[model samples]
Each structure stands twice: as structure tokens, then as C-alpha cells.
Target: MVMRVVVIRVKILETNQQVELDVKSTTVRELLLRLGLTLSEHIVFKNGEVITEDDIVEDNSEVVVFTVKSGG
Candidate 1:
């Protein structure tokens, strides 16, 4: 029997925090939720490309998140 592990690197632009996670499969939304973040309040980028919350994050991938801000 063999087991597979997926590791993802995450970075939060606002907080300048970096984390590495070991997961089998996960979506951007799930990752955000795990990190105590809100979907509508942040944007996700996978390997320098923008990705939606529903998008599945790949193994050994880099995920970057930026907080959304609105000002008048």
C-alpha cells in the first residue's frame, strides 16, 4: 500500500505570513477557511496566477493571498 501527500505553501500578503500545509486535496476556499480567512475579503493566487475559491490547489504549489480593500 502506498500513501500520497500533497504539500502546499501559502503566503498572506497583508500579514506577511507563510505557512506550509500537508493535505491530500484542498480547495482555495477550504484553505482560506482553515487559515481563518474569509472568501470575499481576500483574493487567491496560485503560482502567480489568480485562482477562484472553488479551484483545487495542486500539490507542491505556492498560494498567495491578498486582502481586498475598498476606499472612497
Candidate 2:
């Protein structure tokens, strides 16, 4: 048996760049790790909805990763 990879569109707020990639059906945490980004340094949103590390990511989902900022 073979498995189909899930595809998602990712957007980076810092660079204002977008990319479509094939990913495994997994949690947001794994996805961020695969993207080479630290979950603590970026805020992730799925299809306009804020998502947590444990959130499940599906195919054709839109994800936006924004760099967390510090304000004083």
C-alpha cells in the first residue's frame, strides 16, 4: 500500500513569500520543524485561523507563519 502526500500552501510573513509543498499528515509542530523554523519564534495560522503546536494539518491547507515580535 502507498500513501499520498498532503499538499499545503505556506506563507512567510517576514519574507512575504509563499510556497506550496507536499507534507505528511502530521501535527503543526512537526510541520514547523520540517520547515526549519522554531515554533516559539513563529506564530502559525491555518486558513486564517490561529493554530497551536498540536493542531492537525491537512492537505490543501493554507498556513501563514509570522515571526514573533517583541514590543517594549
Candidate 3:
């Protein structure tokens, strides 16, 4: 079977630029690695809800990846 992929452009706060990524995996973790990103303690949200690396991303899903920071 041929799987469909969706490429979504996400804006990263640190870079202030849009990164177009093609997701064609069964899990979000695969997509991140394919985009050359690592899943650390930082949080990742899909439409505002926190999602884990094991989360399955459906077609046309909009994902936002952000690194968590702590400061006083």
C-alpha cells in the first residue's frame, strides 16, 4: 500500500523561519528524525495538546515542535 504524506511548514520561535517537513511515517518520532530533529525533554504539541514521540500522526495533521526553556 502507498501511504500519503503531508508537508507542513512550521515556524520555529528560535529561528523565526518556516521549515517545510514531509511526514510519511506511522509515528511522530519518525517524522522528527526524518526532519533532523531530536526529541528531548522539550515539549511537542499538535494543535495545542502535548504529544509524545509514540503518538500517531494522521493525514493533514498540523504539528508544532517547541523547546521548553526555564529561566527566572
Candidate 4:
């Protein structure tokens, strides 16, 4: 099977960092892993909407990862 590559624009709210990544069109869980994400204290937004692990990361799409603090 052939894998599809797409450009992913990621914006990390806490660090004010913006990065562009070229990744496969797979599940969000895999994509996040590709980005070296290991924690679950953040939320992901795709196209200004909430996304889950089972969601597909579309080609040429933008994603935002917002870090949140809990149990204050």
C-alpha cells in the first residue's frame, strides 16, 4: 500500500511556536506521535473545531494544539 504525504501546519499556543510538518494521512494519534507528542494535557483543534484521536489528518490542513492546566 502506498502512503500519502501532506503538509501540516501546527501552532502551539503556549510556546507561541508555529511549525510546518510533512506527514502521512493517518490517524491523529499517529500524527501526534510523529510530532513527538507524549502527553495528554493538551487539546487539538482542526479547522477551528475539536478533533479526536480517530480523526484523520487531512492534506494541507492546519492544526492547533492548546495546552491547558488542570487541578489548580
Which is the leading candidate under TM-score? Answer: 1
Q: Rate the local accuracy (lDDT) of all candidates.
A: 0.89, 0.83, 0.66, 0.77
For model 4, the stretches where C-alpha displacement exceeds 4 angstroms are: 1-6, 70-72
**Cα misplacement distance, residue 24 of candidate 1 (Å):** 2.2
lDDT ranking of the models? 1, 2, 4, 3
Best by lDDT: 1
Q: Candidate 3, overall lDDT?
A: 0.66
* TM-score of candidate 3 on Cα atoms, chains taken together: 0.64
Sort by TM-score, top down from the best: 1, 2, 4, 3
Q: Candidate 1 has which clashing residue pairs, if any? A: none
Q: Per-residue lDDT of 3-71 in model 2, one digit per residue for the tens?
A: 665688889888798877787566888888987889889889976879999988888788899889775
Q: What stretches of model 2 exceed 4 Å from their correct place?
A: 1-6
- Residues 1-72, candidate 1: write the lDDT tens digits: 766555898999988999888886699989999999999999999868899999998788889999997743
As a TM-score, model 2 comes out at 0.79
Stretches of model 1 off by over 4 angstroms after superposition: 1-6
Please write out the lDDT profile of model 3 over residues 1-72, one tens digit for every residue.
965456654545544556666654447677667666677734567888988999887656676777666553
Candidate 4 residue-wise lDDT, 15-65, digit = tens: 798877776476777766776774486778998999987888876889898
Cα RMSD of all models vs. native, in order, equals 2.7, 3.0, 3.7, 3.9
